[model samples]
Target chain A: MDDPRPTSGPVPPRRPSGRLEESKGPLVEPSAGASASGPHEQPGLGHLLANCEGQELQPGLHAALEVCRPNTADLDDPALAEVQAALAADAGLRRRLASLQQFDQALVAALRDVRAPAGLEDRLLKAVSALAHSEGVEPLVEVEAALLAPSSDAASASCVPPASAEADHAACRDEAGYTSVRSGCLAPDTVLPSKRRAMRLSSRPMVLAASLVLVVGAGLVIWQYRRPASLPTPQQLANEATGQFQQDLSEGDGMPASKKWPAQVPASFPQLRLPQGTKWRTCRLVNVSAVMFDVTQAGVKGALYVVRAREVARGAQVPNTPSRVVFTQGVSRTMWRQGDYLCVLIVEGDEQALRRLLRPVPPVT
Target chain B: MVQDKPQDGIAELVARYHRELFAYAYRLTGRAADAEDLTQQTFLAACAAYHSLRDARCARGWLYAILRSQYLKQFSRARRLVINEDPTELEQIPEELPYEPDFDQELLQQALDRLPAEFKVVVLMFYFEGCSYKEIAEQLKLPPGTVMSRLARAKQRLRDALLHTGQPAFNGSMEAGVPQVVREGTPHVGG
Candidate 1:
């Protein structure tokens, strides 16, 4: 069987006319009378035609040539009109255009077959819904407050006695009894109407007092439960640091000098002592001056992030010693403050590995 | 009722264009998870800014513009770390692509991935998304002439790549003289 593949060869150098000349192979063949131009001679028609084969066309002519059959809109384009007129006059150019169009269609058709992963629509919907919820007009806290208002009002009303004396009390009791009956809370035939009325009038004040206590207690509980959790937990901070480190490593692009830490580091910067057999890969400043170092030990990767205390919010506290936090199975973070910088160390193995890494660092001088 | 709300319009937009946006994202990032994240982030940004959109017809392009912007922001760090390479030298590519009647999407994708980010994005916008040169130039904040030049370079590179990879072979015929018929109703190549 004959080997059908095009023979491998180096790309031919560009001719003085800035067009790539076809090399001697199955890649491309110059038509009749088409040959390479000499150094002193201007390119001939065959050379120009060969150049037009694929490389260079008039400014917008390449785009125009893509239209297999020009329509009214396509014809409306002055450049397309010129190119189409040229194509109408030349059969060779038309064939070349047809070939290019076929190739373009084939590529487009192939790409169209590569569908997006399944459930992407559902994932997008869920994401959009989450976005909307975060940006909604009524916040969760405010909505809960509005819902609690009416109940609170009813409780407060039942607590205060009517100001107009015994006659007003009787009217208030009558109104409450009427409301209860209308709401179907007080059913007929379950008790004598007079006895039910007497019981309601007696218990109304106590019910109001109890409701006030219950509402206040519930409000306190909700307030306690709904308070925002402390964000950027030690583990989360470590993950962020490691994530940035890993991303930089995988990108494989040499870091620019400007992104590197200052030659004369801040006096308060922490000093890190890596374990034996580990070497420091690189250090970079991230998120407006937080310095991070990429370290690898025995093929295990880790990151150390240090940010100045003054750069963070006021009242931010950093522990004096390495405090460990487990992010998940086999991953642990150790964090502490040395001088003015809050330092975090993240390791991929167990807590002992993290402890070992953190054990050697001396206190800030 | 949900569809009537301005916010809910975002859901409709996602439903309609998520696949296209994801494909574009996947092409740019070359990772499925990154593509998914980029797609999700684009829709989220669109939802947040949906109220500012005055024209519904512009939503498709708007979403794409947002995705491009988000991808840039997310990868700006990695991009900054990239050392500039000379553009004139063409890398050696494989000469024999898998011979299949149905074009190998993966081979084509690999070829596209080899293009510089600037050229790759313009090609994706122009060819895949049907963006006009002017529209792409405006979206990318580039001159129209520059867009044209980049697009031409990109197409030539792709053609060269396909040729080197042994594509454009119809019905197992690898010979040079095999004539391939152009499909009826060829698409209007946008300027």
Candidate 2:
């Protein structure tokens, strides 16, 4: 069967590739060479031969030869179909068309790859430097230098931000050009997005939900994991924190303690103004640290009392009867005398050393 | 603005992706200025909330994650883009680069600069990095189909613009630039 009527949709009379692309993928206009493809090329040679066979062009061949260029309009007519078919039949024509298409694709790719000009690069660099300098140039200096190098503005601009003066601040980072590093160290926030503007579905809501879920789920999670409550309220924790601080301040420096109180605050301590032969529950002497005391002398319990480095700073001392037990010892420590501030610490053990540990109960006034 | 001392892995991630991240930024906002600012802020934000990062190697995704959040924040502060119609495929891409002038690459760049925001980004990632559609989809959080159509529309638009006009002051191309892509009706094959 005859090759089923030129299936390739109206072979479209021979025209420039540029125009062909324009009407299809691109808008390639006719090249300056367009006018040169005048009429003679069309009616194609076949039509001319037919006309000659019909006895009309023997006279005109010379005229046609005399006329140099082909009429582009004639080449664009439907009558050129017969000639086109004839050309298609020729292997040479087929190869030529393929070669032309390849050439066209090469041209497009070349154009695509073209680099930005040096002037543009220079301007971009200068602008980048200026912007970077404005932001205090320590970090962007390298990028500024890269801008000054000989890259074409096309590549730079195609890749870089616009050259408008307003964009100077925005262009500082781009000035140095971009470098790829391992994920997770550099700030992606710093890179200018080329498109889509990084749209997000939700903002505070996600965070709110996450944190809320974290808190609510935490109870369930903790129930599942049975983790300890690692934290407590300020006041309840204050005493504990105070104890740690005292240890850090005093014993941390390797100085010995004045007197020793059992690790757990003592079960009892002698009270002030007790009857002649009466023994009393010793009050717990929890060290509040740093010129503060937690001596529970019967009536007193828990943490409260101020001690000081300087005698005068110690303020007034409470008076008790004749054989009072006062815990005091001046040791070689850099703490207390560091501009008149005192620190305290609680240590373990008792008596035999008590006397050496205790200072004279203020010489009964 | 990146968190050099990030609060968590995600924050570190923002800093890690800082430089390479701008290409995406520029692609998103269609303005280099906006992209840079957006990037810096994203890093800063990442650092501020380091606890949010779950994966370290997914840093690129993580940073991009922050950029998305930050961009939204910026949107409320100032009006950057106001897309009405579900922006045509062309609208999604950057314009096609045109012929170089005297071998100057800027002309082609100028053409690219004119493409729509989304389209331009897709093209950059595809041409410059040759990222797979899946990767693009993941980064942008767009459906893979959307990425494909966007890319197709972007390419066709670029081809159209390069062939038509390659000037800074020129206005509109029909189905050429990102804004006015001509519907080839059928997908473009070899052409």
Candidate 3:
């Protein structure tokens, strides 16, 4: 994929002109009475300056001290003691340490001042909400219902005020009310008010049970009667999957090379085998649960998507078949069935690289 | 329902760390738009993997790890990517700093912008994030000595830029050229 965004700003690169020490005129001049004798005798960093005697400060020793000064609290090296000694003996060294600390404070302040863009939190919430809605809205709805459902065990209810559990259930009821009010603080777009109302109405045990049965029955009926006609075409499935892959690539950013494939992926699914190490995460494409693997090989990147063969459109072809490749939007894509799993490979290169990426396709079990 | 919802935890996490994380991302990416994108991606990844977070206290570090990971993946192969492996090939540091060492933050950032990603990550995690050398070493999977080495080298460059030169002074090539497409995120589907 090509990057339209600039990695950095318009700052022109500058060449460092002089040596670090030369830019600064000089170190602290030694005190008239100071001597390089010892800390107990001299009592200030001026004694160390007396040692420098106008020659360049020892870079090796100074470099070692630089590492210790900022991290004195965390470091346990014997060198830390030397840094401490230098600090204790020289008021100059102590002042330098203080300056570094102050600089650190300023750094944290400056960086922290780079606040998140306005509405970032709102955007994040909406993105997560959309993902949750597609992956499964029922779970969130059920959670809302469970929160509102009255409990006979009020005394044992987790939300009951610690002071006492009311036999009248008023405390538990009030707590639940507070909980609902708090949930209302979610972003405006997170959960619709009408949906919350529906969930609340279904909080009754009988109502919830009936709704569950009806939902299951309706789902089965759709699968039996409506799905065959509704299945998307091979092209449609590929386009949708590709769109999703691109969206994920754009939004998901990049995967860490060391990140392991999520263990949550069920064992029943086929494992992705690519010459390049891959990281897998669960995703929804074409309304079906699938695993998306972020693949990279020889510095080229691509995505390999695996989903159940039964889930893609009939035109996707059930059962094993030869991989078919096509090019779209300057990328190469291919789809084929291996056992019960359907695989789609997308990359920016020619058919050879795309095929190369999917090499040694594990003998279909 | 009886307990705090997972979303609640995520909301709290976002509220606490989003700004800090965005700043870190900005420093890493050297651009606001890319930083915003990286921050959003970090949170999305965080939400997806929220369950793996065993301790709430570790969320800050965990989120940072994710952001850095995303940054590396996105830019590791970019033309500007560079790593100075010789830790001992030291840049000269000022013998003494002004009592305050105060300088323009943008200049400091510009200096930071000049560093290779490897050195840049270390410097930010240490100074900006206030991560201990140990914490940085553990997070980046490098030896503590290496962390100190990178931090020391980076600090010298920054100190030179901020205190001595009064402007950014590091030398590096600009991006060779923009990719034809956002190479990292490209995907296509064809019949």
Candidate 4:
């Protein structure tokens, strides 16, 4: 059978072998009297050919000799004349050359005779496509477009979010080296027939409804997983009081020397008062009116916020005693309902310090 | 205007050259399964390095180079090929054949599989890929004389095996390297 590929297809240019260049040098003939073979002396053709009888020539000399043979011999080689003369002079050498030539021809024929398996191309394509996908390399644009084509029922396609898909498509199209076979937007016809068939047969409203239900179920599961938590009522009151205290320190007016509550202080908290020498300021926090007092006790700075008992949070038992304490953000807070008002003291020191400040409240005179 | 990417033609490239590449791979590794794997790897690798291929006309050579590189990377470490120290004395051919012999593909492949890796590669590039001695030298980064010497040694070894003039055509004595196929009388090829 004729070989499927007769010529070397699209072969790169062959670089000329160094053997040809080496063979271009003048052939030096041995003198008739030169009979002794030495490492320094160049052997005659007869001696060189005979040397192959039981041993191999050195690689360099071997290449030079082989290049004088018919298959690979450079016709322009100066040594070709001497090698041919020597071959003509020896029948044994001529026979060996003939055998070598036949053997080379036979090897070439055998090697080229074998054919690739019939399914190799298909397998290769599929393997390469799968490899590209696994490695995150995009397939040819047409195959990518086919895989991402939206179904005819826009509602069914909503799960894929066509706006994002279109944006990606536009970005891919604008990429410098990305190639597209078609000029404009992807046409529905470019989708595979099998895919188109599946779409046509399975685009029922019931399937779309089931898909939507699955999506909603997934959303519910995620929502249940991430629900926000509510803090305990007592802790909530402590957080709000401490927040107002930190805010007053950073943004509220400087404390006035009046240790006594201002007249504007809600009458609901008339019972609330601090140490006599402490300075005071009045501020409203949310729906609750409160007075912020800057108190120094035992040389330690602290803040006290007083709000009405009802302002603490509905149903939260008014912390009437000094036992309720909350620690947050490096400040310790103690809250207790003083008569009709809630008094919260925030200090960077221990809870004992807070107890000391409020223990001898020094009745408001 | 958007130009078609060269990568888009990879599928077409497979169709055009797969057979030839597979044949070359089969010559190097004497089994259909291994040849398929090597050829597949070549195309897969080509997809990644496709940009380095500046000329479409030389795609055949480029693909062949990738296949050779992949083969060496895979087998070079796993198998240690034993190159006979003496190249000229590697094989002795009979002065003449009893009759003109018919060459069998299997026999030739078995003979090829027996050659050292370096020689086998040179032979394949020279005869199978139609690369010149200098081309093989450049690809393998060896001297041109070394390429010719290895080619000659490989051809002689193949000649003796095919002629069956030497002691039992391939004794399957594969030093440390793996045999390309299950030889006759052996249950399986060994590593």
Q: Give the winner by DockQ: 1 or 4.
A: 4
lDDT of 4 by residue, B1-191 (tens): 11145446567778777766777777777665566666776676666555545545556656666676666555444446676657464124443331123344455666777776667777786666655555555556577667777876776667667655433333222112223222344222111
Q: Could you give the DockQ of candidate 3? A: 0.08
Native contacts kept (model 3): 0.14
Tens digit per residue, CA lDDT, model 1, A221-319 = 886555323224434455566666556556854322243444333433334445433323334343335655554455555666776654444444567
Model 4, residue B79: distance off in Å is 3.0
Candidate 2 CAPRI level: incorrect
Cα displacement (angstroms), candidate 1, residue A279, comes to 71
lDDT of 3 by residue, A260-309 (tens): 65553434323334543456667777677777777767766678667776
> Which regions of candidate 2 fall more than 4 Å away from where they truly are?
A1-365, B1-5, B8-15, B30-32, B72-113, B124-130, B138-142, B166-191
Over the stretch A58-139, how does candidate 4's per-residue lDDT look in tens digits?
3344443443323443424453455555555654454344434434443454456544454556666665555445433333
Q: Give me candidate 2's TM-score against the actual structure.
A: 0.28
User: Chain A TM-score for model 3, please?
Assistant: 0.33
Question: Quick one: ranking by DockQ, best first?
Answer: 4, 1, 3, 2
**Candidate that scores best on lDDT:** 3
Candidate 3 CA-lDDT value = 0.51
Better of 3 and 4 by DockQ: 4
- Residue A7 accuracy (lDDT) in model 2: 21
The residue-by-residue lDDT of candidate 2 on B64-169, one tens digit each, is 5455444443442343332232333312222222211111122234455566555555555454333444445555556665665665555545544544454322
Where is model 1 chain B poorest over a 10-residue stretch in terms of lDDT?
Answer: B89-98
